[model samples]
Target: MQKTKLKALTKILGQTALIALITFVMSEITLRIYNKINPSFVFYDSSYNRFRGKPNAPDYDFKLNSQGFKDVEFTVEKPAETYRILGIGDSFTYGVVPYQYNYLTVLEEKLNKSGQKTEVINMGIPGMGPRDYLSILVNEGLKLNPDRVVLSFYIGNDFLDNYMTANLRTEEKSYMIALIKSMIKIQSNYKGKVLNPTTVQYNDNLPTFTDEKYLEDTINKSNMFVRNPADGMFKGFVDDAVKDLIKIKQICDSQNIPLTIVIIPDEVQVNSQLQKQVKQAFDPNNQNLLDFEISNRLLTEQLQQANIDYLDLLPDFKATAQKTPLYKPNDTHWNIAGNRLAAELITQHLTAKNQP
Candidate 1:
């Protein structure tokens, strides 16, 4: 009787194991098919030391080219009479909007309409910083033989991103974790959240210009240099970023490519109401609200000292904000109007430079 019962138990355990194996295989197959159909995937790039979008990903209306850039396809060899401009930076340059709506694309359209043969390649990668930009330029940007390079330096959290690059670790996700996260994302969408559920929801009752708690939180989230924890490490990050910029300039100079740095300011910097709120929140006594501009001034000064050409967009953005909203209502990134203005400004600057 004991031997018979032991045999039955063994049979039960074998059935369980087989079922699990079959389930895992089915899940793996389904995931691969889903990924192929909806390629919203980002994978770790060992060479660049960061995560990059998958090549040829059909993510929404935007499609990444074979080179993992969020732009149309192009060969390594430049076409005759076609001037290529490589736009490099973080998400602002990469853009979250449709491909044709991005600033680089708009700039290209305006340039071509003005009778100049131009192709602006969007080399922007989301969540990258100065170090990643340098790595990308060395490893990929130069290989395309661009005639000019524009670095869109977004002053929002670049210093913080640069500082954090020192501690960046390789992304590792287990199959089980991925499955769970995917399910959670689906459930979040079902509950009316957007496709990407990483957005922050602010309190409804908070005043725009006077709520201390909300303003403080916004400052901490929006301006990395002004955050309390960044006090001791701010200068170090700025120095590191400056060194990387110099390296980028050196690379561009060697290839005889004109490198232009375009300074993109944060929404708070241009929004008067937000600025007032931040000052009240952080400096009730009106002590030092200008501390956030320190990083911008430092970078500008460094560019001047290095004799590098840079266009500060703060004044223009501020001026434009008086008449229109350049940024999204709640998000940090620029809206369609903002991209249009940026493209217009960049076109004017470049057109002037190319004049006889």
Candidate 2:
């Protein structure tokens, strides 16, 4: 009886080992095959939550094809006598479609025409908010010793960006690799959807996030989407934001360089009249929108109290959004025209401040 029991136990252990080996082999094969088919992690989807599909998702540095600043690239650092402007923000700052008039490029051209001896570096990354910009300021930007650091703080998502998704672990290459891997998984599940969603043509030509529908959803969900634990005014995010602001202040003060914070308007805060249209389109029930008044008051009050110099662009952005759609239809990023407007506004402010 003892001999029979021992034999049974051995047989059970062998089967378990065999199963483990098969599982490992399958996972390896899947991972490899997946990488082969889907090169980019980004995919297209029509789901409201995921307007643009990102199944396997690229790393933070993955440059999408529609990026606005694709035509613009930075060269090696030049001498200090040459004025350099480092522009930082999320995708808006990094134009979605390649262009000559992307705000950064626009500013550079304008500054050059005036002979300001300036080079504007587009340091914008998609999905980054204040924290990511702050990180770039310290880690990557300061080394160049920019004459002026223009921080374009997008009111809509930067608040959330400050609290969450601040620090990312992967570098650009590893991120691209992971994105490729994710694409493979998506292809496995994909039926007939095109690889690029935004590439498709649409007639409405409405801006993706700025519409009334988006603002309503944003207002309702704002509370649910904090960038960090201290996203509220009196808490950690406020303190962190202040600290980040101060750090930039200190850098400028030390270098005797001017610092400007360009407060980029979120589509939600463009005002009730404009927001109503979006509400009508997406949620006639108006179930998802937030109270713009309360949010605007809180944000404005904080910056004012901090004594930070900011150019609130809501009034102007609202007018522009009303006249022409500033956002792309398939993606949550500003189109070239929107970028041009932003740059023009910033230049006007700067030129006004510098006037003799």
Candidate 3:
């Protein structure tokens, strides 16, 4: 009886092992197939501070050059008679739109069309902040021998991100686990409501607002920066960010590379209707509202003190937004129109500076 029972147990164990092996093999195959079909995934680089888009991704028809940047291959030794500008920033610089439609590409085209040989290498990575920008410039950007370095400073969350850098890390997960999680919708994209005036409901007579909750949250967090600069948390972030920018300037100055800091305003800043909505939502009882430009003014003051060449896009974006939508209705990043306008402005500035 004992021997018979032992043999039965062995048979059951063998069958279970075989089933597990088959399941693992099937999962591996499915994951490979899924990755091939959908390549718009971002992977964590242990070396970099944030996630990087998958190299040679097919989903967005995106291709990462050898250095993992979403740009064409470039040599450390820049070619003669060719001017290269390294654009570094967060997603606004990386651009959600197609590579061809990106502002950097448009800037390059506009410059080249005007008989200036230029190459704008996009070193922008999504979710990066001033700290990462400084690091990338010091560690990698200087090696490329760029003539100019353009830093696109998105004011939405860069200060917050720079202050809260301790929590940034890429999780370690196996391919099978990643595939399973993705299949089950465990990974989700951020869905911030667009504050563009044209897309939201507006009543000329009645006070109307959309995404009051988001607006409230934004106000609660960011209002301190404008209203109370002496707040410890806000002061800390500003100090660190200024230090990072100063470091960036020092590096560029040492290398004899012209650094241009482009200040990108928040969505609400450019949309007057949205600005009104924000005021209504955040302070319904009061007629006076804090100027949203306070944040930009603070940064501008620092740049001026440091003698950093900077351009604020709020005025230009505000003017252009009056005629057409510059940002997507559902997303925070710029649309094609915004990208084109930015390119035009940057082209005009650079060309003017380049002129004898």
Candidate 4:
């Protein structure tokens, strides 16, 4: 009886192992097959009607690196010391729209048309925030030794993205995980095919909260997961950003190169209804994400303390949105007309600064 029972147990174990092996093989085959098929075209959903037909690039060219970033390729031709500007930021700095519609390209065209010998290199990448921008500036932007650096700070999601990804790349294990995450995102093209549409509703008649006390109270009430960088969890984020801006200033000062920051205003800040909706999501009492505001405000103060030149494009960007469909109703990025306006504004600033 004992011998028979032992044999039966061995048979059951063998069967379980066989099933597991078969499952693993099937899953691997399915994944490989899914990878082989070219996915459908991905489109950016617009939140509003005005951004309809705004130009955008249909494909991604650069692959994500192990660092969770794409190796941005730039040409080595040096402009004849008249003006060579390297524009750095997230997707906005990146020509999100088609090549011609990219604001950097527009800025280049407009500047050239104005008979100013200027070379503007677009060093923008998507899904990046201030920390990533600063990292790229330290790691990549410094190589070219540009005459001037134009950094765009997208006010909507940058602060959060910066905070979230900061720690992921700081430690060795976490850095590897982030690299894998970026590689996984390369599969977004495949995943986006079956994506469902999502809509955000805003009551346009909502009133704006203009008081700081209300803002702080609202933020404290709404934000249950506030990880204060001062408390150490977000130290990587705080260090990367604060230090990077300092480095940017130090490098520019040492080389006599100029640095200009373009504060890209969030669409919600312009549309009162959008602001209220966002406030409701973030901090109903504060209305604005004071953390984001504090970070940018501190960055500006740091720039001032370091004597680095800067430009606030919020007013101009807001005005352009009011005039044209600069951003899609659902999307926070600039449309073609908005890109043109941004390019015009950036070029104008650069031109004004370079005036002898």
lDDT of 4 at 290: 35
For model 3, which pairs clash?
Answer: none
Clashing pairs in 1: none
Estimate the overall C-alpha local distance difference test score of candidate 3.
Answer: 0.73
TM-score of 3: 0.74
Better of 1 and 2 by TM-score: 1
Top lDDT hit: 1
Assess each prediction's global lDDT (C-alpha) against the native. 0.74, 0.59, 0.73, 0.56
lDDT of 3 by residue, 281-346 (tens): 667776365577777888888899999988899889988888888875534578778889999988
lDDT of 4 by residue, 303-345 (tens): 6776767777666665655656566434456667777888888
Candidate 3 local lDDT, residue 153: 90
Comparing 2 and 4 on TM-score, the stronger one = 2
lDDT of 2 by residue, 1-356 (tens): 99999999999999999998887667656655664454222322111111222333322233333323232445457655577888876667755554454688788888777767778887766666565666777776788777788888775666665554444334322434445655775565333333324444432354443334445555553452233224355344545665676676676677776777887765555544545554555457754543444544555676677666677776787787767776655344566667778878888887788720
Q: Give the Cα error of residue 228 in candidate 3, in Å.
A: 4.0
C-alpha root-mean-square deviation, candidate 1: 6.8
For residues 4-60, what per-residue lDDT tens digits would candidate 1 score against the true structure? 999999999999999998987787677556655544333222234234566786545
Ranking by TM-score: 1, 3, 2, 4
Task: Look at candidate 4 and give me any clashing residue pairs.
Answer: 47-329, 47-330, 48-329, 214-285, 215-286, 218-285
